[model samples]
Target: MGLLSVRNRFIEKLRNFATLSDPAEAALEAATRNASKLPARRDLIREGDRPGPVFVVLDGWACRYKILPNGGRQILAYLMPGDCCDLHIGLLAEMDHGIQTITPAQVATISGGEMDSLLTDHRGFARAMYITQLVDEGTMRAWITSMGRRTSKERASHLLCELYLRARNIGLTDGIELVLPLSQIMLADSLGMTPVHLNRVLKELRLSGTIQLRRGSVAIVDPARLAQIAGFDENYLHRRLRPAIAG
Candidate 1:
């Protein structure tokens, strides 16, 4: 695809929740001019590596995770198309969590110098980036709440809801259906459940008319009911901010 299309994806992602001025749009497009395609299940950035360029997902999914001493892994966050890897990670000495591709992906690497110049010269874009960071933190807090207090059923349902909402906002879904590239094991790891238990919960949701988990896709049969079951709150997503739309 062309660079303009890739930049448009970034614009679509941020414009879902925040807006940018014309200068900001032009800067982002220029800065993200060159992108590389990444194969599925590859490491974009690993734990303990020196911080590298900021990654912006142009297509497909990636995730943040950390490996435990027992060889287990916990998935901290999911990065969808148009979602960026942590921009501030460049400021750290070493990465605490690793980012890896969940599917074949297109990624743009923004060096610290480019990012600093963009932020310094474009106030509106900087504000949008800051808001994006805040929203990411809010999502992490919600994940903590899910892990700490939600039941297994609620936790799974909440994650599905969260992913659905996020993908929908970025125009990745049609009606109630979207491609869920994750395997059962990945979903289980992210939800703090065993594969068996996660399978059982998914079966339950399927049987209860909440969702249909087919191969490579998830279809919410009754989003309202599912959201009620999960007690999902969309306030933290913050989909509205003031700025002019750019071409």
Candidate 2:
């Protein structure tokens, strides 16, 4: 696909959170013009690396992760098409976690100056960016809740539901089916499960006719049933843009 089209996907995501004026859209277009292609399983950024450009996913998937002392990796967040890695990461002295591509991907690296201009000069863009960060925090809270309180099966279901909705939000889904592009190892790491245990949970979900999994895709056979199992609520996603707060 053309770079313009890919960049439009990022614009589409921002539009979910705030109305972007024409100049704001043009600034984003200019800021994301420099994109690089990465192969699957490549590290985009490493822990302790000095912050550089803000990375935006143009296509394919990437993840935020950290390696534990025991050498195990914990996947923190998935970066799908149009998701920005961190709008304010430039302020950090060094990265505390790593980011890696899960599939062959296209990522745009926006320089700190461009990012600062967007945040300082464009009110709508700034609001959208801030709201995106808030939504990211909300997602982290939900993941914490799942890890600390949910059963293995519930965790699996909850994650699938979240992925499905997120993909749908960014126009990545076709009906109830979406490309997952994640390995069992990746999923297990994200869900805090052994691959063996995750396999069992997936089997049960399949047997219950809640979902159908293929090589790189999953079909939600019964989304309502799946949501019920996970106690899924879309509110945490904060899908709509609310009125801006008055200073």
Candidate 3:
């Protein structure tokens, strides 16, 4: 009773879900309905709302942010394709932040009605979605560690390297270059630094011969040296991607 035609597109994506029996086929079928696809900088969802199915980030970068008491927006996290965006909130009673696009994006919103149906009908799907949120929680812990313990320069480099690897694995990056639309201001917000400080760190990386960043292109002159300086570990992402139903 689902869209049976576009099964091929879901394989690579659902392979990371672990609970998907036939990732390529079942996941494609599950993605039957897409309401509206909009460009970035639009609000996809907001805070203080009820839980829903999930937004399967089909493409582009989005960030969850909350307005602080001081009238500043505190960016919580960045969501990529395969990320559940608000999976944690969906399981809970309320939303804490608003999810908005950062780039010209493509997002498919899974319907709440369909989710209600899944909880009643598809145990496998329900369980998978729950675990996916847990996976999300683990990543939050890692982000916190990176921000609190690591230096600002390392934090900035770490986040960039993380995005590069994620994009590369999904065929978005070729390892040499990353297409990032984020401004230094946004980078400062995400890394908990000021624009002036971020520029200094970026300059340090450039002077050290580790990275060349301009416009949308980011080239790691020394990938290993960059990783060493950033203290990045891709274990959280890669281990999550290891095929559950291996061939």
- Candidate 3 per-residue C-alpha lDDT over 45-88 given as tens digits, one digit per residue, 9 for 90 to 100: 77887766567666667888887778777677887655555543
> Each candidate's root-mean-square deviation in Å?
2.3, 2.2, 4.3
Q: Which of the predicted structures, 2 or 3, would earn the higher lDDT when compared with the native?
A: 2
Error of 3 at 194 (Å): 0.5
> Which 10-residue window in model 2 sums to the lowest lDDT?
1-10
> Could you tally the backbone clashes for each prediction?
0, 0, 0
lDDT of 1 by residue, 1-247 (tens): 2223434577666665446777888778877777788789999989999999999988878999999999999999999888887778878999999999988888888999889888888776777788789999999999999999999999999999999999988778869897899999999999999999999999999999999988999999999989999999888787765644432
Location of the lowest summed lDDT over 10 successive residues in candidate 3: 1-10
Give all candidates' CA lDDT scores. 0.86, 0.89, 0.69
Q: Residue 61, candidate 3: how far off, in angstroms? A: 1.7
Off by over 4 Å in 2: 1-7, 242-247
Candidate that scores best on TM-score: 2
TM per candidate comes to 0.94, 0.95, 0.83
